[model samples]
Every structure is written in C-alpha cells, then in structure tokens.
Target: MPTTKKESLQFGLMMCFGMVLFMTIYNLFLSGFIEAITLMEVIKEFIIGFLIALTLDIFLVGPGVKKIVSKLPIDKSKKINMVLAMSTLMVLAMALFMSVFGLAISYLHNGNEDNSLLKDYFSTFLKNFIVAYPLQLIVMGPLVRYLFIKFVLKIKCNCNEY
Candidate 1:
C-alpha cells in the first residue's frame, strides 16, 4: 500500500491517463469510436505491441546499441547517443504497442475487406508513431521518471533507519 495519499492519487491518475491515451489512439485510427472498443481487441493489440517492443528493446537495442554508444567520448556525442538510444527504444515500444492493438481493433470493427480501414489504421499508426514518439520520450518519459525517482528518494529519506 502507498503510504502517501499523493502517491496513490498519482498512480491512479497515471493509469487512467494511460488507458485513455491507448483508447483514444485506438479510436482515432481503428474503430472511430462509433461503438465501444472490444476487450479482445484491446488486449491483443496491447499484448502484441508490448511483446514486440520489449523483445526489440532487449535484444536489438539493449546490448549492441549500448556498446556502440558507450564507445563515444563523454561529450555532446555521448549525450546524443543517450538521447538517440532512449528515443529509439521508446518509439519501438510505442510502435509495437500501437500496431498490434490497432490491428486488433480495426479488424474487430471493420466489416468489409474493401473498407481497408485496417490498412489505413496501420498507416496512421506509423504516422502517429513518427510524430508522437519523440514527444513522448522528450516529455512524458523524462517527466514521469523524474517524478517517480524524486518521490522514491523523498520516501527513503523519510524512513527511520533501524
């Protein structure tokens, strides 16, 4: 249990926001929100995307990319590599999540093959990925990480050492 009311509140808010964000993205491309998005579609897309992103992040970027980045001198290049690495990882994660989830939703909602809504949704997903990923990394990732870290540190400092 969270000791601080603020922590509990923030956790709840993050969850709510995340779900809303996910649903909004799904509707904008896949379903258009004329009807409720199905749970199966949501779960499929989220799981597939998350798995793809996690796998890519761990296997592709985690070791090889870091080693290459680590070789750079501690200067602007290093900073650039750090930013690049983080951004790339985040984008991949987001892409994977959006793709699987979007596909599932679009497939579920679309009635006719001629509609091609799923394909269009995929394209939109990629387009949105290109635009939104940088923003998420630059804004959401740093902000949330910093907040959580600071919150944890504050809690730790407040603890009575045995």
Candidate 2:
C-alpha cells in the first residue's frame, strides 16, 4: 500500500490530468463546431475556471476523499480501481464546481447580461455542459485512469530499469 502522502499526490496528479484533458477536449469541440464560444473566449474561460476547479479538487476534494477511503476495508491491490473510482467522483464534483464558476465568471466578465454569448447560445451552452460533463465522467475519468495504470505506468516502470 502506498503512503497517504503518495496516494494524495497521485490523486492530485490524476485530478489535474482529468481536468485539463476534459477542458481541452470540450474547448476544442465547442469552439470548432459551436461558433458561439470562440477559441480565445474558450481559452480565457478555461484559464479562469480550470485552475480554480483543479485546485479545489486537488487540495480540498482529493484529500477529503483520501481520508474517507483510507477508512474503508478494501484490499490494497485495489488501489488503481479505487483511484479510478475517486477520479470519477472528482469529475462529477468538479463539473458542478465549474458550472457555478462559469456562471459567475460570465456574469463578471460580460455584465451586459443579455448580450453575452451565453445568452445567444443558451442551448449550445446547455448542450456542451450536459454532454461534456457526463462524457468526462464516463470516459475521461475511468478510461484515462485505466490507460494510465496499464500503458503509461507500465512503460514508466520498464523504462526505469534501463
């Protein structure tokens, strides 16, 4: 079993990885197709909210979850599975966090209220959130974790023997 500190570190890394990957994917597709949110606008919004959600998940959410999970009677061999599960929870948690953060940021940046892209593309906004958030939870979180543990982690271990 990894130490608490190690697990915490791993979880933080995974959380950040998930957040950035999800944001990049969402921004790319939304900007390319939706036209409501431009590349620059996506970058700005992502910059403002991404770090906030990442920090929240890493410092606040991840550690709290670690404490809880530590108390569970699960086997140590299940660490990878546990990390994947926790990452999914973290994504869901951050989705709500980012949505609220996005709303607040939109209000602050473009106080024109009705003239913002959000107002112009309300349906697009809703679609993006509904689709992206769940997709992250379903695919990015667990699948990425699995790939990391299976492929990337294996490569790293093998390469370290050189």
Predicted model with the maximum lDDT = 2
Off by over 4 Å in 1: 1-31, 34-80, 115-124, 160-162
**Clash pairs detected, candidate 1:** 45-100, 45-101, 49-96
Candidate 1, residues 85-139, lDDT tens digits: the string is: 6456545555655565556555666644665765766685776576566555666
- TM-scores of the models, in the order given: 0.51, 0.58
lDDT of 2 by residue, 39-157 (tens): 78667666766577668866887667667666666674775767655555555555555655655654554454566655644543464467666666677656666765676567657
State the TM-score for model 2: 0.58
Best-fitting candidate, measured by TM-score?
2
lDDT of 1: 0.55
Task: Report the C-alpha displacement of residue 124, candidate 2, in angstroms.
Answer: 14
Clash count for candidate 1 is: 3
